[model samples]
Target: MRIMLIGRWGKTHALAKALAASRDVELYSLMDKKNTGIASLSAHYELGNIKDLSVIQKFVEKHRIDMLFVVPEMSLARGITDYFNEKGIPAVGPSEFCTKLEGDKGFVRNLMKENHIDHYPDFHVFSDKKEAVEFIRNYSRPFAVKPSGITEGDGVKVMGIQLINKQEAMDYVEQIFDRSIGGMASVIIEEKIEGEEYTIQLFCDGKTVVPMPVVRDYKLLEEGESGLNTPGMGSVSYPNHLLPSLSKNNFDESVVIMERILDVLKEKYGEKYNGFLSGQFMLTEQGIRVVEINVRPGDSEILNIIPILQTDFMDICRAMANEKLDEIKISFAEKSTVCIYAVPEGFPTPSGKVQIHIDRKRFEKPGIHLFQSCFEAGESLYEPSPRLFAVTGTGDSLEEAREKCLEGLSGIRGKNIFYRKDIGTRDLAERYMKKYDLPGV
Candidate 1:
């Protein structure tokens, strides 16, 4: 089968490696833009724009592409899958209509409320800053202030980095509505539920849903969970695919909630949903409160889960296209995985010129997978781009995998390069373990 992946960055790199091992699968990546690892991983790729429907259509015809894995949410939001369906091309991704569950938070919140989904939170959306200020002024402690649209992971502000007091909340409201960040015409103030945060990734064909390993991604840049939130610093998952702080029942129930939402989408749109849908959940005393839905795979989270997948990824994609996900067997290895990303010393902030030296042999070591991101491949090694890259380690235990990743990252020698050392550490896992025994406060 001829398969084409449409995306860039580390997530695309990780997806490429996962499907590289499949039989009878000729893989191609469509990177509209130049990025790290593109020069190395994709031998057969179109240098044109990934967002342009014509570029993808031309590549599909020239390569006789049988299946497509549209990786980025942006592309999906722009109706990539809808066009593919029109062309009789099979793809694994949600349609533009489905992206409303992701792109427009207000729509999703209302959908959940109308459907009586258990994960919906108390929230209010406002287009006027005066009404927003007046509403939040008298509101109680511990609330989330968020822009209605994307801010490259900088949109939502809660008790992040530090507790979000009312005054800081006032400032965030001004930043979005007053400053028009991410072109926000509206803002959402949500009841900030306190708890551990994690992401639940699922594979779907608009009917049968298959759940991947539940992964807990760390947003804080510091090891001790201190520091500003980057796109994502690192992530970890156990062999069971459930965090210690989360219960199996909670995981299953959350899946039920998500499945129902998909059912509603299918019924409402009268279209079948096919693709990866991830629910960012905060495990609170009330249950799994879904914070957001990533229309595509999570970045660092995918790096953690792919290594432990026992089933062929292409098989799932094919199943999704064929509407036979339920028939296809889904399985994962009884192993733990850790993903750690390396970025500029002050990542999410631009870094000036800096050459990075990588031990290519480190990627060849047992149980190691390297997904290069911002850095581009050099004649000798690699030169730091902006985001650098990520290394994933798989082992019998999370701690061991973390050590393996840390050891692999230690091989990248450069100046002004930084990564969190605390990811996948036993010390941090112990804290979540304590949460398992704590009564819901």
Candidate 2:
């Protein structure tokens, strides 16, 4: 089978690695930017705008692509999946209309509220800056200010963390409106729910939904979870397919909520949701609260997931495209995984490009996987657009996995390179466990 992968980043590289593992699959990639890691794996590689339908159409016909596996949310939001499906080429992704679950936060919030889906935070969507500011002024508690559309995971600003006070939130809202952040001049202000956040990713083929291992992603730029939010810094998953402090009940509840949302997409909106569906949840004082839903797989999380997967990824992709997901039994290895991302010094804000060096042999050790995320500027040189690359380690326990991951990361050398030192650490997990009264600290 010939499959074309569309995306740009470490997640896309991870997908390419999984697909390349199967001898029955031939990989073709179309990336907006060049990723040497993905390029090396692809039988054919082309650099073009993933959102340009004409460019993609020409490439698809040129390569005689049989199937498309799109990863990035931006391409999905541009109707690339719908476009391919209309042309009778099987595409593994959600349609443009279905992408609003992640693209338009306001739409999903309202959908959950109107459907009476429990655990949704109180929120209001506003297009006018004055109205948003007024709402902030009148609100009694701290809230999160967000752009209505995709922000590459950097558009959100919380009251206590990013914004100082109500006035700062109002100012941020104005900036979002004025700058047209996330390509939309609208904003969503939701009551902040403070707790330990975790992500549940599932595969859907319209009618059937299958859950993957739960991942706890660290989004902060700095360690101790205190810094600006970038795409993702790193993530951790255990051998039992749960985080350190997360119980099986919590994992099951997250899956139920995601399935219900998929049901609503089909029954209420007449949209058949496909591909990967992710529910970002927070275990608040009240209970598990739905933070948001994403149409694509979580970065860094995907890196942690693909390594432990025991099932053939090509079979899963085919199942998704053919709507026969129920026919396949997906499974993962009984192992823990830790993924750490290396980024530029000043991430979430532009900084000078840093040259990176890596010793590929260091990743040759068992259970150590390296996926590049930066742009190649020269031989043995990389320029970080934001993230440089990721090193994932798998073992019987989180501690061993973390040690392996850090050992692999040691091979990566560069000036002005930054990464979180505490990712997948027992200390961090214990902090959450004590705070939430969860067992297994």
Candidate 3:
């Protein structure tokens, strides 16, 4: 089967590696605004972003592509699948109807309540900043200032760090009113629950779902949750696809939540919701509460989850195409995976320019995998991408896996290149583990 993967920088490099080891499947090509990972792939690749439906349709028709798999938020939010269906080509990804889950966090929170899905905290949804400001000034309890629509990653400020005193929160609320930042006119004042957060990802075909490994993705740029949030920094998947301290009951509840939401999405929307459905949840003293959901695959999280998969990547794609997700079997090895992202010195903000060089031979070693995001190379070593590359390490234990990642990252040479030292480490993961053991119940 000829498969065209629609992603700028995801498991493109890793998928290329898997396809090379498989039979009867061809990596048709890739189209991304940047050629970071696409440039390194063995198959043909074109440079174009996942925007503009006309551009994608023309490319698919030109190649006579049999199947299409997309992984970007913008393209999916714009209804790429609906466009592909009209053109008679089978596409895999959330449709315009399904993307509302991620595109509008406020909507999902209400949907959960309407469906009687428990664990959602009491919240107020409002459009005007004046309304939110009034609530913040009067409400005594600490809460999170969040945007009702998509923030990409910004726009949400927690109570302690980002939201300092009541005055600072009022200022943040004013910022939300500004239409320039993601055009977020509405905001949600969510009750901020104290707990540790982990993401549960499942593969769904309109009717059934195959749960992939549960992984934790770090958003903080610094070691101790200090720094502005980007889409993601890195992630870790422990043995058995669950964390050390998370109880079996909590894990099972998350699965049931996903199943119930899947049913609701299929029933609420006429079209079947396909592709990745991720629930970013926090395990708190009150119980497990979902933060939000992403219709597409989590960017950095995919680094660890895809590498150790025993299922053929193409098989999953094919099953998704025919809406036969139940037929596809998923399994993860006992080995743990640690994924690290290397970014330009100015990551969350000003991403300065620098040249990044890596030894392909060093990356070829066992347990080390690299996926390029956005680094440009020239005769004299020119500018670098904001986010350069991702390095992954796999081992029997989390510590060994993390060490492999750190050692492999050393081989990546660049100026103004920095990565979080604490991501996926035992100490950092344990910090969240301790939250579950808190005394206040």
Candidate 4:
């Protein structure tokens, strides 16, 4: 099978390397907005930006591509997938109907509430600034305001009760509706849920859904998630901790929430939909409430899930193409893994030029994987850009894996480069305290 992976970033790099390693597979082409990694791979084809349907058509026809693996930010979803299906090219991503799940937050939240899925507190979607301000001023506590479409993580802003006065609240309403994507005004406000957050990733091929390990993602770009939220800064997960069967101990409460959400989507949208379903959930005492739904794999979390997957991910993609989900046997390792981002100072935004020196041999010492980001492929280590690389560690325990990641990061000598020191701290503490019957809150 010839596979074409979209987005030549970190995920594409890892996915391409993994898929190319398989004896039964051939990576035909890879397309990115920019030609960053093209020089590295001989067979790699740079299609520039896949913005228009005509461009996508040309690329597919030229390569005779069979499968498309979308790792892009997803605005290209509707165009890419629709073209593929029309041309009889198999695709693994959300359909036009399902892309709205991520494309429109207001729509999905209403669907969740109507279907009895535990989401954030009750809220209203108001197009008018005055109406939204009136509601926000009368609300009891702080709430989260977001731009409905892709602002990356920068779209979400958590405002306190008194922080947003009449004037500031008025400004927020304008900002929410500032940008629009896919023709809908980009903005929604919701009462914030107070609890721990986790991302539940599932691979679905219309009928069957295969869940990955429980990945606890860290949002903050700096230590303790204090600064702005960039694309994920880091993540960690225990493959052994994820239960195969529905049980109180091993089975996650969030799993039930995700299953219910999928059920509702499938029932209404039809059984032909196929893609990766990711739910950003706030795990509270009340239940698991969804924060957002994504159409593709979560960034840093993908690094963790791939290592534990005993079955080839390509097989799952093939089954999805054939609509034979049950034929794919999915299993994971009984180990833990952590993927940490090595960021530059003033991140979640740009700071300035920074020098990064890395010793690959030191990081690859034992039980560790390095995924380079904002970098170039070469033998001599160099800082092509600010954000040097992402260092991942795997082991039997969280402590073992985290230590290896931290030790690996320390080896990188860089100027004005900084990363969150506590990527997996809260979750590890939460897991340990739960074992002792203590408070993880």
Candidate 5:
């Protein structure tokens, strides 16, 4: 099978690694920008804007590509899948209209309310700054303020964490209206559901849904869960496929909610949802509450889960393309996985790019993998805008995985590079459990 993978990020690098491992697969890549790691792995590499259908169409025709593995949500939002599928090329992703589940927060909130999907948080969408401020001022409880559109996971501000008080929340709404944050001048004020957050990613073929291992993603930039929110800093998955603080019932409930949402997309909206769907859920006192829905795989989360997958990934992609996902039984290895990202010192605030150095030969050993998120600036020099790369480790136990991940990360040397030292550790897990008053493993 000849495949063309889209997008330019750490996830693209990870997917390229998985696809290149199959001898029958000829991997090709079309990146909006240059990514040396992805370029190195592809049989053919093209630099073109992924949102431009003309560029992609020409590439597909030139290569006679059999399958497209689209990664970025922005490309999906641009209707790349719909365009290519009409041309008889199978694209592994959701359509443009279907991407509203992640692209538009207001759409999702209303869908949940209209469909009576359980676990929907209290929320109100607003376009007027005055009305939004008035609503937040009178609300008695803490809430979260979010841009109605995608902000690459940095637009949300929760009360008591990002925003200190109601006044701050109101100020944020005003800022959103003035600045048009998240590419829109609208805001979503949602009742904050406080708990430990975890991600549930499922593969869908417009009918069948296969769930992957549950992953806990750390969004905060600093240790002890302090600092600004990033796309992701690190993530962890256990052998049991459930976090220590999460119950099996809650885990299953999260999957059921995703399935329900997919059903609504098909029945009510006439949109058959395909590709990867991830529900970011919180295990609150009231059971499971969904934080948001993602149309693509989570960045750091995918890094951990893909390494432990026991089944052939190419087969899964083929099944998704053919809408025969139910024909295959998916499975994963009984192993714990850990992924930690290394970023520049002044991340989320934006600083000058720092030079990065890595010894690729050192990672030939077992249980250690490296995926690049940075770009090459010069000979033997790399630069990181936010995250540079990720080091993943797998083992029979989480502790062993954490140790190996740290050991693998040691080979990556860069001035002012930072990574959390406590990811996939017992201390961090216990701290989170205590903070939420949840029972530990």
Candidate 6:
């Protein structure tokens, strides 16, 4: 399996590491701005952005990259995947048009309204602060202001009543402008849906779509979901909650929204437009409403779902690349797994290098998988950095998994290190599992 994975750095780093252990898999090349610690494993390294199609073409030909696995950077990833597909290379990703469903919030909102795919109240798009203020004045407070682009939960800010003042809203718009360029200045302001949120990830080879076990992610930095929003702090999936309801779960509405969204994509975009797909949903009194769509894999969510995947990850990718997904049957682990993300203090930005010491033996019990993240040193001693590594634990129940994850992470010692202590807990996972009312503690 020769695969060309494209992303910024950290994502590519994790992808290469996950695929390296496969005996049949060979990482052909990696295209990124800098070395994401994948140079040691990748057969060839192309040091440049994916926007350079000329360089991408040369690298693909030189290394014979069989398939392209695009990580999160969707705007660029979508464009690169589109370029490769146009060149007649076997690629697995949504088409540029389908990706726009995620790239442009305006487009998505319009689609949802047109299709009557569940609604979360009214939303307005703004290019100027004055018009935005007028719209807010005409309506309610406590709204959600989001950048049309930049998914993975970035560019989303939920304002409370007090924060909805005109000056604060203008400041936020200015911040969005600073982060955006070109016509990206447009922002999506919507009525904030009140309720718990959940993430539903789907795998599609363009046609037969399989929804992964629903996983819950803690988007905030601290407990009670109060703090600055990072990409993803941690995540866990409660299979117990999902088993009862492909039928009767409260989240059945979420599944409906996902199916509806996929239907729209297949109908509007071609069924051959394949790759990973994700749906973010909110469960409210009105039912589950679509929050956003992600065209590629969601990192923290993937960590939770992958263990349950009984099928071979490489085989599925190969089948997608070969256009034989119909012939492949995917299965998942009957047991449960939990994944916890650990980061250094002042993280989501550069902090100084820190040292991490771990008592490997203490947490090396059965059903534990440790994934290395922002570690910079050797196997024995993990030299500290902004992010260190992820510790995942698996057991018969969510509680057991939480215990293992907590214990495993406790073994590691590092200064300026911080992690959500509530990962895998019942209360933490309950909000996400609510829709699927199987059995709860």
* lDDT of all predictions: 0.80, 0.89, 0.76, 0.66, 0.89, 0.67
Stretches of candidate 6 exceeding 4 Å from the true structure: 8-18, 21-23, 29-47, 75-78, 161-166, 178-183, 241-253, 269-272, 357-365, 375-387, 429-440
With candidate 1 superimposed using the best TM-score fit, by how many Å does residue 203's alpha carbon deviate from the native?
A: 0.7
What does candidate 6's lDDT look like per residue over 350-425, in tens digits? 6766677767786558766555555444444444334566777777887787788787888878777888888776
Writing each residue's lDDT as its tens digit, candidate 1 over 1-441 gives 778888877888888887777776777878865565654555587677777888888998888888889987777878988988887988889998998777788888888898788686789999898889888898875678878775555567775544357777787787787788756588888987867888889998877899988898888777777667677888988888887777888889888888888988888768677888888988777767889877888888888888888888888888888889889789988888899988877666666655777888988988888887764445434444446789999988887898899889988888778898888877777776565443321
lDDT of 4: 0.66
Name the runs in model 2 displaced over 4 angstroms: none
In candidate 4, what are the lDDT values of residues 231-330, reduced to their tens digit?
7788888656542221334236666676776777778867345768887876555655678878777777787777667788788888876677798688
- For residue 346, give model 5's deviation from the true position in Å: 0.7
Higher-ranked by lDDT: 3 or 4: 3
Candidate 3 stretches greater than 4 Å from native: 11-22, 29-32, 377-385, 435-441
Candidate 6 TM-score, C-alpha based: 0.85
Candidate 5 regions off by >4 Å?
A: none
The reply for model 1, stretches above 4 Å from the true place, is: 160-164, 178-180, 375-386, 433-441
When 1 and 5 are scored with TM-score, the better candidate is: 5
Which pairs of residues collide in candidate 2? none
Pairs clashing in candidate 3? 32-48, 33-48
- My TM-score estimates for the predictions, one after another, are 0.93, 0.98, 0.93, 0.86, 0.98, 0.85
Q: Model 3 Cα displacement at 434 (Å)?
A: 2.8
Better of 4 and 6 by lDDT: 6
Model 3: how far residue 127 lies from native, Å = 1.5
Measured on C-alpha atoms, candidate 3 has an lDDT of 0.76
Candidate 3 residue lDDT tens string, 90-162: 7878888888888877788888999999878778888777888999889888888887776665567888867
